[model samples]
Target chain A: MTTVMVVDDHPMWREAVERDLAARGFEVVATAGDAGSAVRRALAVRPDVVVMDLQLGTGSGVDATRDVVAALPGTRVLVLSASAEQADVLEAVKAGASGYLVKSAGADELADAVTRTAAGDAVFSAGLAGLLLGEYRRLQAGPDPGAPQLTERETEVLKLVSRGLSAKAIAERLVLSHRTVENHVQNTLRKLQLHNRVELTRYAIEHGLTDPDSA
Target chain B: MAGELRQRDLLAPLWRVVVAFRLVAWVLAVAGWFRERDDYPGTAAPVAVLVAMAVWTAVVTVAYSRAAGRRTRVTLLDLGVTVLVLAATVATQPAGAFGEGAPIVTSIWVAGPALAMALARGRDGGVAGAVVVWAAVTFLRGYVGDREVFNLTLLVLTAGLLGYAATITRRAELALREAAAAQAAAQERERLGRAVHDGVLQVLAAVRRRGVDPELTRLAAEQEVALRGLLTTGPEVAVGTADLGTALRLLATPDVDVAGPAEPVELPAHTAAELTAAVREALANTAEHAAGAHAWVSLEPADDEVVVVVRDDGPGIPDGRLPAAAGEGHHGVRSSICGRLADLGGSAVLHTAPGQGTEWELTIPRGTPR
Candidate 1:
């Protein structure tokens, strides 16, 4: 059974998320009102996924997301916030949140986002996905002219990522094992010091790893 | 007020008329004396007085035209010169030659000092100076006749009327100065109103529109009222300096952490208010945008400046986000945060990027010279 932890400053919001996850057949391991306690509870429970609010009273949700990801890389964070700001979405993404959903999202959508995050898929609200994609393209245009050269296989993975292909899909297309593809992705991430696929895709586009015809 | 006499536009024509009259008196006195040359046996004394009067009138005409020449000392000396010339005419004239129809050396030239004193010191100075000259004439004549008494009263009345006119001119000048001051103050209030409109009022309106929490809406309404009062009240006219620490303390709340020196950070009231307003706008941005954020504010006073830092632990503003926000009509960071500091001759530096939190350093110099 999938396990989830809810973190929100508002009692009602935390309770609602907890109830929704429970009704969806997911076990809610714990709930917290702030970043510190959320991190502590997340570590103790080792929930498969954490549904976190961006604002957590006196603590920061972004910081909590970072802590949880660092402490338990196996655990995923799905941020739910009242703001649909581009900066907020990007920050949460850079902090290692697997998904971001606004509070205005329906219960079903929240449940679906949580399931996708647990299944290791990056989830985003409707328009936010495109916004992040556009931001990635814009950021890619301006960077080191002398970018680190990528291996032939890393470039192939980069092209697939830029075309918005999933890692598993890229592995199947390339006739490689999923673990080998992930290792290539990790190697590129280390060379670039980028935190996520979003940045990597942007870097690929800037360095002309992706073809316009393929995209 | 030192150059009040010369500054009187109303008196400029009067001064010209007085000068013209003195010139006419000199011409007339000379003509009258020459026509009645045989009437006075001694020519030396009257001729000497006549020459002195001509020289003095010529000197005064040029001197009074300049501001430095219009000093109180010069006015009094002019009066003394006229009085002595009048008295000398009496001593030089043969007995009974200064009777009715006879010409005095000063003639009507005494009007110069009478009108000048009125312009300088208003009614009282005019009346006093006229009386002094009138007494010298009466003393030399050696008898208080009907004509002498009539002339003395005439001098006093003319001086009084001229003095009254001077008082009116002075009052008009004062009123003009006060009107100019009021206009400047109104302009300042208008500028302050615009700043408030861009900053606090916009935040409050946004909060009110969100309508998520009733308590937040109520707080916004309360602030709206307070902000309106602040805009209309103009800058406070309190005597003592404003304490920056005390003003900063007012911003500290349960969610915000404020740290500053125990000693009062004494600053001019307007500067303190500007600095505080900038800080308030920064806090408002954090509350409205940064989710689950905690804020910290610190103040450090350097040798000649005060450094205030406001930081938040939240999803930091992304690179290029501010410019993008500006394009999308976000004025909080532009007008409220930076504009206010710029007006006070201070600077606001924003430090932020994606993933990292945001911090702002506001540095304002001491003793703003508004």
Candidate 2:
């Protein structure tokens, strides 16, 4: 049986989780409450998986997981907490936690997370995957060129297009001639290698240059 | 207690009004005394009138001070003193002193206080207090001096009318407060609903609807659910960043009950973000290790420090033996929760036992906002 460790402070909650895990065919190796003890237990038991609460009375699970994963080497940690803050999800991944799951998850998901963690598969919440991926892409992309090589006028024209403003409206707002605004739009499309306003909107949104509310 | 204190603050200005009334009355009475001496030189009636005015001024002052029974027993003492002064003045001056004017003046004093007290207690006792004071004033004014009982009665009736007006003001105040509180509460509910609608609930519904990802759709759905849970709720939530409690509650799921205070507690946005990430890592550990075991997560105030605690009844950790726990991992507790807290000048505490369970507490002081 795969050995798993549980860390939490509430007795009833701990029991319910343990029972669920046991039923799911995982052997419970150990449990811990605080960060120090959690580290010690995770190291000692060398459980295949560790389910940790992001919040602990005396310690935090993220720190505990770091220690556990560090010492045990192979132990995978699946973080469980009531919050779904994006930073926490991203941080847990940073801390060597294999998965980040909110407490509102069902018993099945909890059990599944342990299995997935043990399988060495990356686990994250839905919808937020885009955010994580986007962040990852940003990091990979490094500091973008000081300027996207687009002129200030180009940026303004793109913003207007994303906002659904007609060339006439953009011209009026910017106090430029209508033909001048259209020229700027054509220039922006060429610079960004975009064909139409739709593609222009997507690019602006991806770069966070456009408001989602506007889109 | 805070509500009561706030109410007291609201009533404080009323006392100032009372003080102003008394001061002016005293001044007028002294002025009237001087006028009588100038107009009716050597006349006993003028002297009587001046004395009466002086005594009435003192009585009204006493009545105002004595009205705040919700405050202390000294008010009763003041009342007794006022009544004595009124009695002395009535015996020497006009018979109308105790006959009718007394009750009306008492009513005036009671009206302000009754309304104030009612706001704190949320009961009709405030109105009752006003009525009792009004009646007492009327009775005292009616039976006192010989200034024609009918005229005294009319004075008492006029005071009652004023008292009624005061009561209306109080009622208006109460209605306004209630309306404001209700508006706030409704706005809060709407905000939370929106968060769910836009974030958590929507994610859940979407996951259910769009579970047909060509690759890892289920995981995508699950991730969306997590993201949704992370979003803040409540109307105030929209105007600014989420409070610690709201963030915790939104992140709450099957593993634990995460809750924080309702009032918005601001933390350094960057620090908050770091700590939030730490919490997420810890929560993931609970889900994987605990295997659906119950858990609790809490954020509390601890003597100039904010403490986050997560607990569960699971097997305990043996003493020492942390050598392997500190290994390098792209995803590990050290980098996830501890490192994040450490970055914020906060430390995490973990306690465990074989049969007992595990409790983790993270204490972050207010000042250390890196």
Against the true structure, candidate 2 has what lDDT? Answer: 0.55
Q: Specify the CAPRI tier of model 1.
A: incorrect
Top candidate (lDDT):
1
Provide candidate 1's TM-score on chain A.
0.67
Residue B14 C-alpha lDDT in model 1: 61
Write one digit per residue (lDDT tens) for candidate 1, span B39-86: 676888878988998899899899777666756677788898888788
Estimate how well candidate 1 is docked, as a DockQ score.
Answer: 0.01
Q: How well does candidate 2 score on lDDT at residue B197? A: 44
Best by TM-score: 1
* lDDT by residue for model 2 (A95-179), tens: 5676666655666888887887788754444312322332333333456442124466765554444323446756987999987
Chain B TM-scores of the candidates: 0.52, 0.37
lDDT (Cα, 0-100) at A117 in candidate 1: 85
Task: Please give the CA lDDT of all the candidate structures.
Answer: 0.70, 0.55
- Model 2 — TM-score against the truth? 0.33
Report per-prediction Cα RMSD to one decimal. 22.9, 23.4
